[model samples]
Target chain A: MFVRGLKSSIIALESNLKNRTLFFLLNFVLLVTVFIEILTYKHSIALEPHRYQNFTDDILIVQMHYDSETPYTFSSIFDRKLASIENVLYTQYAINQYIYNKETYQLSVKIKGTSGNFIENYDIVDFYYKTNGLPNVKKNELIYGRVWTNEEYQKGESVGLIYEATAKTIFGKSDATGERLNFGSHSIKIIGILKNTDDIKNYYRTFNNYNLEFVVYTPITYLKSDSLIDYSIMRSYNNDILKEIITNNISEKMYFYEREDVISKTLDIKKEQLSNFYYVIVVTLIICVVGLFQLIKNFINQMTFECSIRRTFGATKFEIFSMLVFQNSFVFLLALMLAIVVSIMIIYAYFYFSYRYVYPYLSYIDINIILIIGIAQLILTIAFTTLLSQKIINTNIIDGVKGNS
Target chain B: MYELINVSKSYGKNQIFTNLNFTIESKKFTGIFGESGSGKTTLVSILGMLDQKYTGNYIFNGINITQLGDRELSTLRKEKIGFLFQESYLINEITVFDNLLLNVLDKENKQLIKRIRELMDKFAISDFLYRRVSTLSGGEKQRVALVRALLMNPELIIADEPTGNLDKTNSEIILSYLKSLCLENKTVIVVSHDEKVLKYCDIQYNLIKNGKLERCL
Candidate 1:
């Protein structure tokens, strides 16, 4: 009996291919929505690890502002207190640009002075350097932030590394390592070049009125200035304690910044995105349920005579209902398979294109969640189709056979 | 044997039949003759258990059909009664073989297959077994309908104008087949307006004025 009913259902479905195609297309919307939700979830998980690795918990930036009445220096009691803390790794004082000059064919650029352990403590190594070796700034030598040829770096020449954008603007070329520039009263020769200037631009923009990419880097003693220190960046395992100690010891004119503040803001934005996605999913599910209910109701109305004919042939009401359910279930399964194939192609194309441009790694989907959602959709389809079929089957069989109301 | 005692049927304010009485016996071909709105089809529907809105006592083989539930009536119809409508009403998308085997749920029975093949051969429709019903001619469709009605070997066969759409020759062919079923101790009841079909019946009835069945010579 089951086999015969199944064969009849298949024939019925085949006879109405046009309607089945429309049905499949309508149901495909639901599958696509669920697929998008899964992709979004995977994307969030992929970005989290990268963000966590970049923004570790041990770093903090202390921005100090002082007027002439209360001048702040790193070698004062505040630094001594910070160094006394047991969890402190180290501290590095950095001076923002203190000099600025521009002349036709002979421009003098401001050089930033820092301690020797500045690069090691801040974990800033992945820049593109012109030479095979990076210049460890000591005493009189400096590293330029631009690409340079090997001939530019001769054994004992006084070299100052200039930023790539500054080199390009001043000399009309990027590899200006062999060029000479004047800073205040001293002349310096360019050496190895750095590829990017975003970090320099940001640091100068914080306190200086001029935002120039032609900045140079040298040791604090090379600058020979006592009041050029802008701020100090410290690394410690316990930033909350460091923050408390600095806040207590510093004068009322100074302020401190913590890296956790940036991390918290980024986490807030991600939370908002996830909350919005939940709303979208709920709205989509409601639309799908209502749309499927109406579709099944109309289909059952159209097949009333067919149901009556089967009933006339000794099919019980349940048997007639089961046959209709089987027919539609076959259509749903076919649509689901088609939807899956199309979704895979779409996801693959999106990831492939994005990998070449923006995102580096391909995101992954959780198969368990997909299977659960698929099963839920199947249950919704069967339940709605069966309920509507039962209602139509309860009508008088004679009226159906006679094609009457 | 079947009997309808004081059967009454109506639709809203319109009355189709009222207090009508009739009896049909086994081993005979009976024809109910009526005009366009004489309620012959309605009477067949009542007798076939397809219409349960009538107030009456329907006794079939010594059981009160009126007291039975829908499930029992369905089983009785499935096991003992077969129906043939004016339109062949076969599912047009399926083949003639599938239409004939439509009511036979247990399709793997060898005995049933043999019986279906023999019946198709007898009707000379073996050539169109695999052809879709929509592609068949009027007479071929009626023959296939007959084969389906008789597939279950029902004790009673109720046909509503089985030859209504056929020609004179095909009408005679269908009447002859119904007459032959009486020799197998099967009761064959046909409702029609055709004098040629009524002439082949062992007993004839005409529904006259005021919802009553009168005997005809």
Candidate 2:
């Protein structure tokens, strides 16, 4: 009996191909819109942790600038006070130089002097260094940043690495670890090679808008005669007190910048984007529901005579209502299945060509969310269709049979 | 048997029937003939339990139909009364066989299938069994409608202008079929304006002036 009813419904659906096609197209658009919204929401949620990974609530960046009147040992004065603070974690200082010239090699490049814990604190990855095949660095030793790896180089008095772009610019290859270069009076031997110059460029672009390619890192002890720190990066349990302390103790010529402020601003922008997507989803859902209601209503009107005939043929009111519901539910289920397939294909294609780091974040497309949305859509459709069918069943059978009402 | 006592039906200010009393017995072909606005259709609608708004004591066999709820009325309609409309109200999208078996809950019952086949052969619609009803002529559609009406073997078959759309020859064929149903101890009530169709009824009533039914034959 169920099969018979199903067969009759299929016939009815086939006979009204134009209406069914319109319904399918409308529902497909709705499902795809919903799927895209869900995908973006999931992507944003996945990237939330990574974006704020370095910007812990308690961490702060304090940039200090000095002039001729300022003391050369300005950073050392804060070191004692910062360590004495109750919630202070640790502080690392850095000095930047853009006028490093190697006369023999004719290479002028930017360099940075960093403290020992710089790599661990900054969350840098793919760091490699070797002094004559011994992968370690000591005080005053140089570490060359290479974009890629190549042949091994012999150890020298000072070990260094060059960025891949720097190697490509001078040696015509990405791997120039075996080469030696001079920085003023110092001859630096290339030791280690870093893998991704693009990552370094992105990091520098995000923080200070400085060009990061071809930059070199050396120990802060290397700047013995010029002991002026450019920036200080630190982590603490109480940023509020630290901010206040820095504001009070800093000289008139020095300025302080906090990392937490930058993260908060970026998160505000992302939150705005998420809210905008939600608005679009809600509006689209409204349009979908209204359009679906009209479509189902029109279908019921067209099937009035059929319903009346069924009622006359001993079909109870519920049976008449169920037939219409079953027919529409079948169509909706088919449309939903097609929409799911299309949505998955679109999402996979987008992520496949995007950045590698983005791939990990795509894993947050929650299956439970999809199921909830699908079930909600199903329930919503059924509710409206059932209401419409009830109205249809309540219509006078004689009027329906005559197609007058 | 069905009886209506002091039955009155009205639509707002327009009255269709007032203080009408009528009785229809089993095992007979009864026809109710009237003019265009004489409420012939309304009378049969009430008899078939399709309209429950009329104030009356409507008894089907021994049960008070007016006292029955909508569900009970629906069950009574399903089990005891068959309805046929002038439009031959068939679902045009399905085949003739499906239309005939529309009311049968069990489509795979061999006994029902055999009965449907015999009726199809009797009506000479066996060749159009798989044909879409929309593609059939008016006469063929009415025959299919008749088969569907009789599919459940209801005790009372109420047809409103069942031959109103048919030509003379097709009209006689349908009238003869209604008459044959009387031989099986089933009551067939037909409402029509056609004099030729009226001549075939065993007993006939004319709904005349002031919403009254007068026995004509």
Candidate 3:
């Protein structure tokens, strides 16, 4: 009798594939939401072990525009002294003229010129650099494309330039080397294209503000500027020296930030964005639960007569209960498998489009989701259906079988 | 054999049967006759162990059924009692053979299949044994129900209007098959509104809406 009940149950489920599909899809949506959220948490865990360290020897120092009332040349007065400070870094930006082909957009080129220490201090080596050498910058040299090339770094010349991700929108599939770019009416030949680094997100997509964008890399000494006074940092061997230097040189307008602080700030911003998304995910899950409850209720109601018939044939309350649960579980398992396949396809597509996040080829589904969904559905179906069918077991059998309910 | 001792049943404030006493002797085909709302169906239910919320003592063979626990009562119903209804309540989606074979869960009981085949052939319903219940005719479905009931080799059969949906000829045929159960000394009780069925019954009882039972001619 139990076997027959199962066979009939399977027939019923197969006959109503549409309804089962809807149920399966709702569970899938919840599974996907939980999967993504758990992945987010996992991302934090992977990142925590490799936390950024702020060594007192390094700092971010910004230099004010050179012409404001300070008449002394910062180069002659500070060059020798600052160079001895250990790990001094400077950057400069130039407005470049270019056209974006994909979105038919245009922007000025934003450039960063830094010494060899730039890549070391940022810890971009393990993530982006494939070689041990720093980006060797020399006068009038450029390294093109998205990343630093060994040939450009090895020559100790500033001629090769790396193209920012946004450069692709302006010159889709075009060999961009040797092209003369006009920046503030000053033309410089594009040398090399930089490959995408993991640090910058979506380095290939085009942006509107070309000047404000990270579009290219060039040799630090090649930049020509009179107002581009030196933005250099001095590292101290101890906190006392660091504090003493900052205390004496402190200005009310200057802003100082540490590397650890910068990383925390970025993470905090990401957390805020995810919190808003959490609300939507939670609401969707609640709706799905309600829908699942209603569906199970309606289905059990329709089977009241069958339950009565089974009871007449000597089915114990537990046996009857088992049959219902077995039916529901079989259907749930089928739908669960289908939904997993669907969700994996979607996750794969997402990773294909956004590979900058180091997304693994596949992620393990959190056990909490499986437990909550699998156990909850099983318990709810059994409880609701059994409660509904209890009347069949206890009711006057004559009316139950006579289609009176 | 089944005995009802002063059994009384009610629905809310409405009393359907009160202090009713009756007995269905072993191997006797007893028919219960009444008008609509005459409480015949309710009486059949109590006999089938389907109705428990009643004030009375029901003794099957020698055990008082009302005192049994849900599990014990269910065991009694499954292993001893059988039922036939006016409309065949077979799960329409399954094949008729599967519907009949489903009742015997003890797979090694080869007698189940042999009994089912004999019953189906006896009722001339063997042709549609593999067909879906929904596709069977009214007469054929009733025969299938008979096969299902007889498969368990139950001690007693409680049928409520077993042939009520059949024409006069089919009704006689069904009643005759039911009468054979009595010949085998299997206690049988049926609730019916059809007057024609009274002839086949060895004993008949009439239930009054005023809550009384009387032996009928």
Candidate 4:
């Protein structure tokens, strides 16, 4: 039966090369899309700074919330405790204004205020320098300038600084580095710019569908009694010690942790995106299957007389059914292969140009997707084939042969 | 031998034919004639065992063919029956040789190839052995279909308007081949409207629109 099927199938295939090519291309594309998503997720996670390779569980961030009715301000409650993490430091920043004329942003942005220790603690020394120009002040000047150096904290000088980008926006493109931009009553000079990393860049820069206005950074000493900014930053000697500090200081209602917490949260974000992706594939699959089913139905109807001829020649119902299924699957296999190939090429192009990573971050193939779709296609093909097969079987062979006449 | 005892067939409410009786003994050439919708094709289908949705007792070589299951019926047909249609129904994607080979089951490679080559030559379609059915002329395709039917050398041959699509010369050629196969002790039943095919038959029946069967002129 298989040999007979193979022979006729080869014949059918030879006669329909165009459709075969198109079908395989479709399958290739579906595979490539999934491959890229999985690969990109892993790559982004790998690029994070960690104590171990793929160390996705080490650190977290904690936020302590105060009851609004309790007559206590977040700044008042958070400031003292945050300053005392042994060998730790702190920062507080706000979003007083924004500039989003050109690009969109998809991720969120947060700013911190601190004594100059905020720079060393976040390990963003270069970022702090690039975003602000240079932190320079004359003696007894009381010059309000962006804190751009680790040396300032050791010297113990009280200063007022503004995030450089915000200063440039308020003062235009001129030398905002030395000019004081007033935040409420106190004025601060912009010193340097923040260096961009992929994760941080995505947060600040424009994506296809989102925009992040802008962030303001200032010294904790300069913060006023009344401000809307709701976040604070804490520096710790190590993540374990930080976790202990947060656990003691914050309530159970307030979540606490380190960088791993961020990664896990990011993973949840990825999973949500993945579920939406799954929905797209499923919907496309359903549409494709429905379209293909109609095609098979039409082909069988047109070939009804021929089926009867085979039946008249002693072709059994199963044989006829097998022939139809083999024919359809042959087309599906070709389409699937083509889709996979094309999809791979597109995803490869994306990963190659952006990261310059040699090995595919995506495995280039996901067998799970294939297995799932394959099983689905098999069941659908068999079910449809069986329905059409029974139709052939129920046909009175005499009328079928004569029907064509 | 094939015998149809009081056979009846209908579609929902349309009774095409009922209580029709006939017998086609072995090794004889028989012809069934009728105009359009006269049900001659339906009777042929019944005798060929392709139309099972009918009330009838079909006995073949003293066995009840009507009672056979799909597998049994198919096995019986493959071993003991072959058919030729008016349009030479061959798969257009395959070569003439492969078309014939399609009916050949899983057998030793050498034997299968040998049999295919022999049949291709015997039917005088050897020149078209590698030609796809779509590329062949009407006459060539018919000859190929005929050769395909003969490959298994079944006991019964049911041809429906076998020469309906041919020119006069090709029609004669096909009729001559059909006659020769009858001489080989195979039950050859040919259905046609053209009176020209009657010359090659030993007995004939004309199926009237009133559902009556009478001796052919």
Model 4 scores what on Cα lDDT? 0.56
| C-alpha TM-score for every candidate | 0.65, 0.66, 0.64, 0.61
Model 1 scores what on Cα lDDT? 0.63
Each model's total of backbone clashes: 6, 7, 30, 48
Locate the minimum summed-lDDT window of 10 residues in model 3 chain B. Answer: B101-110
Cα deviation in Å at residue A165, candidate 1?
42
Chain A only TM-scores, each candidate in turn: 0.48, 0.49, 0.43, 0.41
Candidate 3 docking quality: incorrect, acceptable, medium or high = acceptable
lDDT scores in order: 0.63, 0.63, 0.57, 0.56
DockQ of each: 0.27, 0.31, 0.32, 0.30
Can you give the lDDT of residue B83 in candidate 3? 87
B54-85: candidate 1 lDDT, tens digit per residue: 89899998899999986788788887888888
Across A106-162, the per-residue lDDT of candidate 1 in tens digits comes to 111222222211210110111111123342212112244442233433222334555
Q: Lowest lDDT 10-mer window, candidate 4 chain B?
A: B99-108
lDDT, residue A146, model 3: 36
Off by over 4 Å in 2: A1-25, A41-274, A350-360, B105-108
Q: Could you give candidate 4's per-residue lDDT for residues A1-405 as a string of tens digits?
A: 668556666754554444444444554444445444544444444432221111211111111121112211224223323332211212211110111223321112222222211211111010111223232111111133334344433332223343334333444342346554332133344453332223432432321122332233333323334222222323333445444444454322132212223434555676676667666655666666776566556656655665676676667787777766776676666655654555456556765676554333244234365456655765776677677667765777766665742
Model no. 2, DockQ? 0.31
Q: Model 3: DockQ against the native?
A: 0.32
lDDT of 2 by residue, A1-405 (tens): 678666666665665566677777877778777876777566665555443221122111111111112212223223312232222212212111111122121111212222211211121111123333322323122234431122222111344554555555444466677766443234445555544335655553443333333444332122333322223323332445444444454322133222223445666888888888877777877877787788778877877877776676667787777777777787878888888878877876776675444555455446466567767878877888888888778877777778767
Q: How high is the lDDT of residue B216 in model 3? A: 82
Here the TM-score of candidate 1's chain B is 0.96
Per-residue lDDT tens digits of candidate 3, residues A283-310? Answer: 7667656766676666655656666777
